[model samples]
Target: MTSRRDLLATLGTVSLAGFAGCSALPFGDGQDEKSDDVALPAATVEPISWPESPFPVAVPSTLAETHRDRARELLTAVPVDPAVPNSAVAEELQSDRERAADRLETDTQEPWPTQELSRWRDRRHAAATVRGTYRAATGEDDAEAVTERRRAVRDELSAFVSAHEYRASSPLEAVLVHAPIEELVSDCRRRTRPGSGYPADPVADPFQAGDAVGLVEFADATLADARGLRDAYLADRSNTSAQWVPLSDTSEQLQIALAHTRSTVQDFLEHDEPPFDADLDGTAGRWLFTEASRRVETMAEEHDVYRDDGDYARAILVAGRTLAAIEALRTTIDGINGDAYRDEVTVESVTRTAERAREALAAIDASESPELAAQLCRPALDTVELLPEVIEEGYADAGRVQGELAWAELYARAVPAATAFVSERLG
Candidate 1:
């Protein structure tokens, strides 16, 4: 089982790279709506156009494969490295030809433009969706400009999804642009003050956006083949699935579920069956792309939930470390006082947890929001320093834990708070 300490010890240390570091260079972590989540490749990480090579086993595209050609063209114009264009910016893509060439490079650079560009593109796509919904609601052809723009946005969305698919991860983490109907059948309303940090006029509505985005039940299968291949590779490398993924509690459960999910996908793919059929009709194209985008968002959320779930589990495991320290401190203090009450006390257990806890605290990005850290994280750390003094003085008994009662109470609160904070962010 990977305990909290063990996980931290190995994070960001994996020799993760694509095809000898040249084919698909490490790029952006993922850029979606909220958070600086990485999306596709960013500057310093370029996608590699794989050289034609025969595989021992044929690699046949499946599921979204029918629309794969357009998706592949997303990076058509992306060169090995893009030259600084004449102007630092170009208002919009010059043409389809120019767009294909510069799309990938443009997304990977300029103060990290992927998220902004994606949001812009999604907003443009939304314009079409809104119009489509409006026309569906009330037959209106007077909006010819809307129809033309809608088609334009539909094409743009197809390109966006193609770029997104190009960046899909092994577990099939989808790079979603925005939520389903929220981004699609959204109201034609804007903020009175765009950046004033106030609520928008419409507020937040849910039912207004039902399964406005479809093709959802197909997610598991879509990600299955990709995930199965990854799992099979890992198992092959280690010669056993157990060794490749040796986690405990929920972590282990999720891993096992992944194996099952991928295997099911593999079975379906091998049988030449798509996990789910998307409505590919011209009328359904807009909805199909919207679902594609929606899946990306859904995948991003699921990935985050899975990751945070592990962190939460890890925190629970580490709380054991805290308890172990408390027990050790209690025993040592019992010996120190010689069966008599001591106002203050000291022990090695306090020091060990305190020192290690600092490392754990640091992992949570302590510098992020100094004020919040000041209130929540600082107190526990401050208590660490006081432990030795209290122990030496044999201060007020902290019951079974020993030393100061405040020390135990402080840590108990702080540790869980940190755990909750990690989960909140994940949600």
Candidate 2:
């Protein structure tokens, strides 16, 4: 198990780029622009091309039963509290396991994007780690002094988990633009602490206590990945016209986006799924999207802090998702009638387009109206993944963007209606 000190140290040092000399890049946008003082990245960036249409993963009853049977496999060794929420713990863990399994298969199968292969595998590994933590917390290793240690571990993890917001990439556009949703989903699910269910209060219920502990260790690892992607943008920022906004603005934008996301999810749950060109209206068709929307809403409420306190990494994560939510809602309702990509989508062209995006971001001065700046900044951060320096070999990274300029024009379009969405209800 990773200690609290170790986790903080790791988060502090993590960078998006691991290659040597990558950290020395300038923070400025290379022109006569004022510094926005954004920090490093924290969460991973989902691509903008993944399917926005929802697809459900049915967890067979037999499979769920199997996991439930083994949920208490580790509890027998330790002196567990009689009130341990075994069923709730099992359900949450199994939900994670099933989701990870489904994503692993989908990500690896033919035609689906493989650019995020490593992230899916890492989630699989994380699910296993949760199992391990569950076992360890139950005193599987040394039954002698388990109770005291479990409480201490849970307290530490609870504090860490509360500090970060974990929500799925809402709106299909956000899902497509951001990194893999499983990363956020898994993190959010772990924080559920299903054992206690409501309020998720940290309890001495050892069998039900591993969720927080496992998420803490997993967070440390994901932060490193977030750094790699974030640093990639930082390194490229000096070349593009993208300017930074105040961390407070970024936080405010995130808070607004999150609140909007919650309301959107509530709307989604209350009404029928928005009519898609495809036949995605039935229960099976809407299951995954509905569940994800619910989770996003729950998370928005759980970690509703409005101030970032100068943490740039947190700002980047929030900004990226908020932008995705904005764009996704547009796509879902407005509908992409035909190909949304441009005629030419080469690396150079995309880079030029991305620079235009940065220019747009730079142009939206927060001094004009912090709310508009906050709204537009989300789209600006969404462009980070489009930088030529960060392009990789995969459908999301190269295929769609290279083949069709997937999200190349998003930032450019975002500039006109940063504040109009409220009046127009466009999003």
Candidate 3:
């Protein structure tokens, strides 16, 4: 295992090599001018050599078994919004097509895949085709037609893969381990798209990657470099030049607060989450939800955050994901109130986090959020910074780090504060 110092030194080398060797990664999205890793040369990103015809030519592994009929289940499950006029559906779809056109027009402006990834290039084109088909399809497509359409799409992609002669990578499994952590989570949350690499699929590997779907394909060397970068980020929070990860939340803060209350009222539930009665109802539903939540919490708490020279870089990546969810709260709140009626600390904290989150989201290819998320996580991230020293120094250190601790405690308070603020204003 490389020591912390050794890892950082190695990362410095890999970053230099990556920039000198290929297109820059799609991170930060020009948000941080200081990130030297995102820039690339003008030789044009050429397609890499592909592998022999034995490529996995079926549906995605997880989707293969169920997709023949189950592929459209997600779309089928969506209930038409009764409030939306049937007359307007076509117009809305037209607008969507126009937006997609706009996206393609700007795709070149976004970060091109830095690695020699044939799939990335191939997937982009396929995604366009699928988007076009879906947009053009009338709701009248019969079940048989839908199934055939799904098969045709799969065949087209499989043909694309088979034609390529892969060299450096196995086209079957692509696991991205690098890129900013917030960006990672954003990629995971992206709705499954035809060419989006089955990002919502569970990563089959052993890396404790959380809701991070198998999107963003990082080269082996790049992940190695990321390990060092994450470690450096954990320790170097106070540096003025440091690039604090920008995580963006597009969730509406008022809506989030309102939704929680509405849910409670509708259910006549007192708790934000109804205490699961596992004994009374042996359903695995809550168990699964609890496990998922536990996975996220454990990732944050057990991450190498508290080490004096902590070094579990992958876990920290997961921690970044947890932070993104927390930060999303604040991002949704941004611009709605413009810090109105919010304290300086709370405003400043979320504002700072929102900026970082947005930058991260854009870098990771998020098409903005549905609503802004909570912005009260900055103080917690900062407080978490001191947790290591407190553990090491015990009671003496606790007093010295009281400010950070207090801020962490108050970080949770943002929930109630925001709820009250929105409820009061709405009332």
Candidate 4:
């Protein structure tokens, strides 16, 4: 287990003499240091304040009540069962996932215009031939007219290709556009439209509107569910108790669940799979519920730290440093295998570290004693020091990491000074 003190001590050691040039000793030549002769600098430190709590103080207050009401509404709207194989929501969720997957595969398989330009060329040739036949039959061919007709054909083809390219380039945008089309098609096919049978204004019916409304409602409800889960996890401190698992032990599980949820939602919106009833109660719904619950719980716990009368600023600074160190390490790792290792660590790891850093920072109270400041600053410093090793490992194969040589040099220079600052302030 990595203790706070250990992390800090490592930081202090790395920063004091390794990175920062400043020494732990007093400045100037060695002389009889007279306390009376020495004049301390005036205090320039400003008061630091904590941020407002995201959750309300009163459990039964408007905020809580509203959330509760929303939760109840969601539960009523979409009944879920963890053990059951399929529910309405699960079916919907699965259908969405399949659709998304189909879209993704289609997008991937669809070659760039440049790769399929020959097809367009053939079409243009055919059009030109038709124009030629018309001109020959009429015996009224004008060079300018022929050029203009060809230009128009080319322009239209170019625009069509460009649109496909744009959609192919951006998965998110493609999904957004595809979602409405899927919804429209689904609504039209369904018999849930208002009126006993299709009549006047058949195109614009309650079912279509209801599908749109349902999509929006589902999005809002999902966010609310996530928030609720996060809050619950944070409030429950007992790690070993049933129904309240320790966050540390369950982080990986939660991450996987979240990823699955995100994937399911993406798939549903993209309409990759055939419409199925199991989607709503499937992986997407369960994952969303689980992940959201965990985040809310974690965030709630973090909120409490801000309320504590601690050195919040320093804590934040420490967290920033920790993140910086982690980034540096990542950079170092990237340098190791060159571009081959790029995106290897996964964005999720970085995001998780950042979240933890934010929580740790919130727990810090900058108004604490110098000793506490040292303790708080230590972890960040140590993490920073490890950057070089990470970089070195990254570059070990190539003998040197590229694009980060300057950063390595800078870290080497700054570590000592930073270390000295912590030591002087703390000791």
Best by lDDT: 2
lDDT of each: 0.27, 0.34, 0.27, 0.28
TM-score, candidate 3, is 0.23
What value does the lDDT take at residue 41 in candidate 3? 22
Winner of 1 and 4 under TM-score: 1
The estimated TM-scores of all candidates read: 0.19, 0.31, 0.23, 0.17
Predicted candidate 4 versus true structure: per-residue lDDT over 1-427, tens digit per residue: 1122222233443343233222211111222122112221111111112222212111223322343344334333322321213344335433433332222222211122211222222222222222222222223323344334334433433443233211211222222122222222232223223232211231223223223333332323223322332333335423322211221122223233323433433332333332233322212122222222222233224323422423122222233233223333333333333422222122232233323333433344332332233332333333323333432222111111111222322232233333333333222
Please give the distance, in angstroms, between residue 380's alpha carbon in candidate 4 and its true position after superposition: 16
True-structure RMSD for candidate 2: 18.8
Indicate the TM-score of model 1: 0.19
- How many times do residue backbones clash in model 1? 20
Candidate with more favorable, higher lDDT: 2 or 4: 2
Q: Across residues 1-427, which tens digit of lDDT does each residue of candidate 1 receive?
A: 1111121222222221111111111212231112112121111111111112111122233322322232233233222232323222112212322433333223222111222322233222322223222222222232334334334444443443343221212111110111111122121111111222211211121112111211111121222333333333333333222211222243344434433433432332232211234322221122112222222233334434534533322222233223222332333333333422222222333233344444544443433333223223332333333333322323212221222222323333344443343223322
What is candidate 2's lDDT per residue for 308-365, written digit by digit as tens? Answer: 2333323334344344434443442343233233233234544554455455444544
- Model 1 vs truth, CA RMSD: 23.5
Q: In the order shown, what is each candidate's alpha-carbon RMSD?
A: 23.5, 18.8, 23.7, 29.4
Q: Which scores better on lDDT, 3 or 4?
A: 4
Candidate 3, run of 10 with poorest lDDT: 166-175
